[model samples]
Target: MRLIATTWQPVWHETPLGWLDRYRAALAEVAADRDTLVVFPEYAALEAAFYGTVTLDARGWMQRGANHFDAYCDGIRALSKDTGATILGGSGFARKGDQIVNRALFCAPEGEAWLEKQMPTPYERALDMAPGEAMPILATRFGKIAAVICYDSEFPPIARRFAEAGAELLLVPSCTDTEQGASRVEIGCRARALEGQMIVAMAPLVGEVPGCEVIDVNLGQARIFCPPDGTSPEDGTLAQGPRNAPGFAILNTLSESLAQARKGTDVSVFAHWPESETPQNPPETRNFR
Candidate 1:
């Protein structure tokens, strides 16, 4: 399977049509082949509001995104169908009854599946966003795929659950505002790959768009990683884009890649995880000082 991820940049669309065209072009660039999966960054939907139909204030982005969410999402579904590739179309704020939640839109050629974010960042919570129940694992023609949105990637159990469920590719769609935030997310993605022994792909939103306080001053890049065991790349990185640059980080994964990770010559993080979960005696504490 070929994986492509976008280091997307935030920009103002003069209209909703412009937003759809941008996504269409982005997906079109890499959808020429079969068995390809592409991902965009979290809150990519927020960019559509810059056209002036809604207020650009951070306080109002959630509502604006909710109002215009489904229509833009339909456009993404059509792109997936037209390209014949599965797409994780980033995330957006969608109204789920009285509460508003951020959702990851995963679309295949057949249809669309929405995954609610299990964790919300401080920034998102401050903006009055509610989190979902848990991360989701979606089965695909190639293999089982899963997603851990942005801050959710920081949690080991979240990624571990997907691995336990027989997932192979883990999608991480993130949007960050600072160097620390970006590095933390990068570290989380790498750690999850090592622990799960599954390919972890991250696509982030970059650049600053004036008048859009929600996703302005974004950070991070598109990167793909796997376990550093003998069977995979020693550095654990399969592909990555230039820092904060807008482009796609593309790579191919063998169907046997996950199989190799567990049986490879190494510390066996994935295999040893279950043993670590077993009940063990507490570490002996001593007063050395």
Candidate 2:
């Protein structure tokens, strides 16, 4: 399967229709000749809050995003139908009862699902955004997949469940306003790929939203990583895009290759993880101390 990830440069729009058109144009860039899945960055739907000339702070824009979330996703679902390719529509804030949650929407001609971030950053928590209690697995023609939203990618257990569920890839959609933040998420993505022995792709929101405090200055790149084994890239980087650029980083992989990787050229970290968890007495180390 051909996997495409983007470092999407956010643009301000005077109208929601203009934003939808912009999205369509972005998808047009792929020119896919075979089965493909395109991933956008986290908070990709936050641009929907830019539907007007007025500026809003993190809280205000998030609330606005919550309001327009469903409608904005409907627009993306239309694009999926039009293009016939599965898309991970980054993420957006949505009001679920009294709490607001950050969620990534996965849609294709066949089906659609919403995956939530089980971990919300401190900045997000300060704005009253709630952490999701569950992480749902997404299924597509490609295979079972997990969309690990932004900071949630930093956690091990979250990605492991998907890997255990037979997920071939973990799609990370992120947004970071600083170099430090960007590096952290990128490192997390690589670590997840190595530990899971599965392909992991990351796409982040780039560019600036001049008046929007939440996304004023963005930094990120599109990267695809795999286990550093003989079956895959030895250094774990399969593909990487120009930093903070508006473009796609593409990688192609087959199920057989992934199966072989898990079976082992040097080692099978994916299969051997269970042995690490078996209960045993702690090794004596008092003499070293």
Candidate 3:
């Protein structure tokens, strides 16, 4: 399957329609093929509010009004139908009764959608976002795919669990500011791919949000990770954004190329670790000398 990952600079705290126009235009440029999977950066839908916050508290920043949030979901549904593309709809503050959750939605062309991301980060906890209960791996025509949002990538066990559950591809959508944040996420993606013998794709928000101090410098780097054997040309990178602006990256073929790498016996690094029989003791005679 072809894949497109986007690094978008969202207008802080704007309406969903405003975000759609910008995102749709970017999508139009990258969505040349219908059989493409697109991943948008987390919180790009609420760029305005994210940037508008003088103090960054997760739950406190999101507007509780139902109309605004519902409109955002409505826009995602429309985009999936209109683009004929599968989307890893970036993270959003989803209201589920008395509390809100930091949720990511995965929407396919058939109008089927699944929600994931069971835990939130420390910052997210400050916002009082509720944690989810289950980790689901969706089986698609392309392959067995899993979804993870920002911060979730930091935990190796989370990625491992997905791989163990038969996920061959992992999709991550993130909203982060510092170079360290970007680098850490990138490293994790590569590590996960190497260990699981799977493909890992990350889409991060590029540029700054107005009010948030955490995003003083825009980090717009996004990438695709593949196995070390270099089985897929699409493995390296489909597209990349500018260091300081919004852009989209497209990989024309991902699934088939990844499968080719998985066919080899020596492809996985985790299989090659040296076994330890016992701890070696220091030589007493040598110490006396």
Please report, in order, the local distance difference test score of every candidate based on alpha carbons: 0.81, 0.82, 0.67
Better of 2 and 3 by lDDT: 2
TM-score attained by model 3: 0.81
Candidate 3 wrong stretches, greater than 4 Å: 12-16, 48-59, 64-67, 212-218, 230-239, 270-289
Instruction: Look at candidate 1 and tell me the lDDT of residue 127.
Output: 78
Tell me how far the alpha carbon of residue 149 in candidate 1 is from the true structure, in angstroms, after superposition.
Answer: 0.3
Tell me how many clashing residue pairs each candidate has: 0, 0, 12
Best by TM-score: 1
TM-score of each: 0.94, 0.93, 0.81
What's the alpha carbon RMSD for model 1? 1.8
Error of 2 at 123 (Å): 0.7
Each candidate: RMSD to true structure? 1.8, 2.0, 4.6
lDDT of 3 by residue, 1-289 (tens): 6877787776653443566776677778875335888887776555423322256443345653222555666677778888887877766666778877666667777555545456687766766667764447788876888877767787877887787778888888877667788888887787787777777888888775555443345575677777667544444453455555676666666766567546653544544422222337644654555
- Which portions of model 2 show Cα errors greater than 4 Å? 32-34, 133-135, 254-257, 283-289
Candidate 2: worst-modelled 10 consecutive residues by lDDT: 253-262
The alpha-carbon lDDT assigned to residue 175 of candidate 2 equals 94
lDDT of 2 by residue, 55-142 (tens): 6777888888888888889888888888887888868889888999998788878777787888999999898898875546666667
Sort by TM-score, top down from the best = 1, 2, 3
